[model samples]
Target: MQWLKVIFAGFIEIIWVTGINTANSWWSWLFVLFVIALSFYLMISACKHLPVGTVYAVFVGIGAVGTVIVDIVFFGESFNIIKISLIILLVIGIMGLKLATEEGDE
Candidate 1:
């Protein structure tokens, strides 16, 4: 359950990142700020049940990969071999971290 919450937090983080990047008006900025706070709150809540190290890495990794994919799809960013390889490596790392993290290892 906490793992799911952490992943949802990452989704919210992507919203904040993209919103801030493209925000041109005060209202949009406010929305981005709300999302930022919400994301942090969710991540912190999840960390209480899971190891901070594992949760933090998973949260950050999701945000990183998600943001990159969003940039490519919506921000007109181009994808290349290097970017693909790096994303794959990051996913593998995140998976490894999840596998290695034991309950109450915090």
Candidate 2:
């Protein structure tokens, strides 16, 4: 459940970060703020039961990867082999960290 919160927060992070890049209207800005608050709250709640470093790392990893994909798919950012390779490497690293983390360590 805690991990789920972290995951949700990470996706929310992606949303707000994208929002910041593209938001121009008042309502869009307000939505961004709401998502930021939601993500922060989720992060804090997850931290209470998980290793902070692991939680934060995973959260940022998700946001980073998601943002890159969003840029490519929605924003028409150019895609290249190098970008995909790096993203794959990052996913491996995130998985490694997740696997390395133990419940007892929390």
Q: Best lDDT goes to which candidate?
A: 2
Per-prediction count of colliding residue pairs?
Answer: 0, 0
Residues 72-102 of candidate 1 have per-residue lDDT tens digits of 9998999999998999999999999999987
Candidate 1: lDDT over CA atoms? 0.92
Which lDDT values do the candidates have, in the order given? 0.92, 0.96
**Candidate 2 — what's its lDDT?**
0.96
Native-structure RMSD, model 2: 0.9
- In TM-score terms, candidate 2 sits at 0.96
Q: Which candidate tops TM-score?
A: 2
TM-score of each: 0.95, 0.96
Instruction: Give the per-residue lDDT of model 2 (tens digit) for 43-68.
Output: 99999999899899999999999999
The candidate 1 region of ten consecutive residues with least summed lDDT is 97-106
